[model samples]
Target chain A: MSNWRQMMPTTEAYLLDKVLYELHHKPDDLAAYNEDKAAYLARFRLTPELAEKISSNDVAGLYEAGVNPYLLRAHCIGMRIPEDVSLAALRSLMKEGDDKWLN
Target chain B: MAELTGIYTASHTPVMLNFPDRIPTELRTEIFGAYEAMGRDFEAGRPDALVVLSNDHLHNFFLDNFPALCIGVGESYESPIEHWLKAKRRVFTGDQAFGAYLLQEALKADFDPAFSMEMVLDHGSLTPLELAGLDPDLPIVPILFNCVQPPMPTMRRCYQFGKFLGEAIRRYDGAERVAILATGGISHDIATPRMGMVNREFDERLLQLMEAGDSEAVVAYATNQVHTAGNGAEEIRMWMAAMGAAAGLPFKRAYYRAVSDWYTGIGIGHFGENSLATVGSIDG
Candidate 1:
């Protein structure tokens, strides 16, 4: 009910949320984590391009593809992107005033 | 039975970590002095358990399973946040006994609050406590609210939740004295393009209502109305919870400063004793 736009429920958004949450909180077993990640991604209609963008910590790309900066910033951090590096990308994304800005 | 000894609200942000850079030295000294003053008061009250009401920074949960309100029942909590500030980090001890009782009572009251045995403490729960010099060994129950992202609960609902929580604390059979600490924003925009902006007018008005003990006026704040100030202003949900827990109690504004450089209002206050508020003093 606030001025902020509602969260996106797309596969990309779901994938990003899980990816961030898992990166910060992963299973102790490596094989189990890989298997779990596969099963989780399988549930979504994720394209290879979207997956690639996330893997690369491409925050600007994520933003352009409908991922809001709030979630994107978390993703960047979980992926271990340097603070200055990720924060710079986030700032650019917010200031872009591009069509991607849902607000 | 355990009794509510002190109820407090303070600001918690990265701004508090890098104080000299964010706030001027003159104001910073005074602001920290207030926290020390409040800390002295808290210790003198001899509280045993402190219930911290704060917001998570999307580090604990995400849009997939964002909890509106959550109670931590774990025996201990760690802060994985603050890598940026490198703020003094500590593993705060949790009060599972009191937390479990609070959870059960809230559920019985028809308020479904999520309970966690493993919850991470972020700056929201730690910043103010460390700055205020709260005894680290004191048992803590961290109650997190959804202040970021959309679909935040209304102040009315949060107040109701707080009322139930207060009742449960009062009903618990223990000799322990409990203190309620609500930590977050008065008015600051952390996410939006206006990231460093602080609304002094909104901060002042809210403080006035608290000093006059007008919780009804405080609860009347709808989500969208507060959005006009800033997204971070949403964290005032914590303050509303404090008011609800201390409803009808007289209060005093401990300190207030609109630190634009820090992107925080730096508002702190306390609720104590019962006193009838003059009706329109709140609305005006």
Candidate 2:
């Protein structure tokens, strides 16, 4: 099984996915996240490391920590994070057998 | 007796509705034309209702409450839930009785699909229909498969469900004609590192298998190797279900093109004896 599936059921992963989902869908949450990143994230019971990852726009770290890639990508778009940054982060996770279709 | 008019499948991407100009004008025209062609075939079936099998894009359900399979029994459905989606906000007429019938039949068959009376549909259901230019007044039933999240129904399970649904549709006396449509995926990545890459080889091979009416081969290949295609390609499970509904009728490809700009391998085809007799492959 993939890491995305393994880490999905944990409280931390759930919190991370929930916050990202809100940041993308809820206007008030997005405004709050933009106005005060720490204050907004404080609403959730996220771990310090998970909060830091969300706070720092750590796409790869969040993904490795089990944020659904689709949700992570949508959140990045909502946050106005450049495509290249997330692309580079995603690229770092690819292995030899991954993305063989691209070749 | 109600007839299973036809089983159709297509790939859904927001870019097709959101950013059509990203691709060349000619390619865009052809893609739209292909959809229109499918629409014509759908109309020819004279279906009393359309049953769309698509997945929710986290618009309706979140991680907190997600079901592996859900059926919408609402009297009407508000679709294109995304405000950012470049499509009109409209309500689709729903066949509440028909949807309820399917739900009851599914339960009798031991397939416990969650049911909702007020499920808002996202682009997954709206895009293909809107592009196909289907009639707004025509009633529809939406069956949502959880392709986005993990632990989704396997390809074989979806196949079995489709087969069961097909028999149920034929047995229903409420509707004289019902058309089935399954949307999503040939091979394209989304939001990941290989975001813009489209897998032509995977798309063509899968289409070939479908064209040959090899449901077993399609299910086997899609289940075992879908991971290599892309995260989005998991939606091919819907295609497997469509195959099951086809009941081994050979598919005729209406159009197929690998559009990386759309971040999806756009392919459209229908299963049955009435569709285009020859396969059409258009690479963009």
Candidate 3:
């Protein structure tokens, strides 16, 4: 909650990091992301369930699997996802835990 | 001895550039106009180097390891990352000698900080340069604080850091006319549900203190209290740091606006001795 902790070791943790990094520095290729998705994802040793989550681009599901939402959102910022989409997706699963502390 | 010629704080959120039309023209003029004013007057000071205080948006650092504070000590730097900003890649001269001098002096002052010779200038630093039409060739010393990732340096700690930084600059025997530019936050968040929310009241409350040179009061806000405004609003650590470096001198308002389009309250202010121009006036 203070500084980010180690990303939990899970398929989503391993695969989502790649998803976000690719989306961040090379977002133009998401369309191509699917064509070779298996080949790219194969390297992660992910189970079929986690591969599905990564390939589906389920941010909420990934978060449930311990992928940090903040890091996930960096992908949103880089990919230029619409604000409403990101808000609806993220809010469905997270409360922004620290909001009540506001003065 | 090196002299701090100017001190400034500005919003570096990139949405303002990407969606300028999202904001009403009147607000745009008011906010950017203030940036224009600051740019003109800041350049008038002809600072040999501008040290920009900002935070990385996970652009260069990650969860594996993040320094609470970092300074670029390279001979030159480039803002090459293209995903968040549309700026063309261009080389910028870095005042490494001065950066190293400040680093040594800061350590001597008891503030432990990390130093880097390689890094990219993200929107947190570059957007202000673009907004103000600042000269890229104007040698820069980029200083970054871990304002985004939380568990960051306390607001008071950041101010103290700047205070010590100012002392270091003054202690250096170099001849550079230095300026300090702190970027980001006047109450706005991004990538969170609160994205697009601007706490005008919160921004103004802090601005009032800044204008009055109340560094202690500014730092009194608990970190969570500041986050109440917005997540990215945490970048106010930059403003607090600038206030400290300014040595408690009152700053003149450059501009203040609650531009929801950028989802940032977007405030600008400047501090200078004798050269404190009137609000909204571009001192020639």
Candidate 4:
């Protein structure tokens, strides 16, 4: 099992911080952030299609297309993404996948 | 003794009630129609008091000292947040006598329940009130259970309490007709890594067990069965208690929908319209 704490560089802050960092800075001179992002993505083996879906904020499409549950959860809790993502899209995703939430 | 004239159970669908985009327009219409049918029953029964069993969503009760079982005996109850919910603001009076009796009986039965005078109702209780078309001035005895937070009651204990509550309600005396309502559950997960999962098959089976008055089976399954049936299923114990209150009554499934997008197995059932003449008493 992947140590979720080890997948990311900084474990001190909440998940929202990681998302905000990715949104603000695509890459940095320091290799630490890049290694962290790469490690995080590698832990789930997120496909390009899944990344695109997350970027598009199409929650229904993600679930309908059978997106990985781990990645989906990470995105939903803003653990790996910023909160500025469209609330409308998030709400739609929630509605589409309501049945599966507690299950 | 005040008879439990009716029973209603509701849960947060976690979706726009009538939004076409969220639920297909046709399905939405059908769901609303079912709500209307439930309303018709409430209108016919005209219950003098509604005993609502619901869980607080961290809105009113925080993590600390949040009672596992709480009875609200305030003169009036109000929901702190109403903007997000379409429900109208309404004040409900409490039945202190009945409330006190329930507390005492639950304790005597070995369940250490709590009492609150300044409790505020949240969407869990308010959603059903809106669906039932109940007047704001209607009297209600709110029973808040610890389902959302940790240290929840065990399935066996919940069912046991249900049996106890059945006796408590029958012991109360009043002219007003009483209605027992339990809100929450039909398979939806929230606030965790597994958010937005719904288990339709489990929901259907639970309804079946409830209709059969098989509390033993329900308790056993809740303890040993797959968690998908009830990741947050502890809340459904409220419904079990309400069902116990109306044991021996045949219930009709007014509505059942597995709207995955809404992340809920929306179900509404009713009793009292076709109740058995005699119900066997539950011994502590």
Winning candidate number (TM-score): 2
User: Measured against the native two-chain assembly using Cα atoms, what DockQ does each of the candidate structures obtain, in the order listed?
Assistant: 0.18, 0.44, 0.28, 0.08
lDDT of 1 by residue, B2-32 (tens): 7888888888776567445555677777777
lDDT for model 1, please: 0.71
Question: How high is the lDDT of residue B205 in model 2?
Answer: 86
Q: How close to the true structure is residue B9 of candidate 4, measured as C-alpha lDDT?
A: 68
Candidate No. with top lDDT: 2
Each candidate's TM vs. the true structure?
0.80, 0.93, 0.85, 0.69
What is candidate 3's CA lDDT for residue B79?
Answer: 82
In candidate 2, chain A reaches a TM of 0.86
Give candidate 3 regions above 4 Å deviation. Answer: A1-19, A22-34, A45-54, A59-70, A90-103, B222-224, B274-284
Residue-level lDDT tens digits of model 4 in B74-106: 777877332334455666777766777777778
Candidate 4 or 3, higher TM-score: 3
For B60-151, candidate 3 gives per-residue lDDT tens digits of 77656789999889898888554655666677789898889888878888888999998877778887887788898988889999876545
Indicate the residue-level lDDT of B132 in model 1: 84
Per-residue alpha-carbon lDDT of candidate 2 for residues B11-92, written as tens digits (9 for 90 to 100)? 8988787668878998899888888888888888899998999998887889989988998899999977775677899999
Off by over 4 Å in 2: A1-9, A82-85, B277-282
Candidate 4 lDDT over residue span A6-27, tens digit each: 2222222223323323432234
Worst 10 residues of 2 chain A by lDDT: A1-10
How high is the lDDT of residue B284 in model 4? 5
Clashing pairs in 1: none
**Pairs with steric clashes in candidate 3:** none
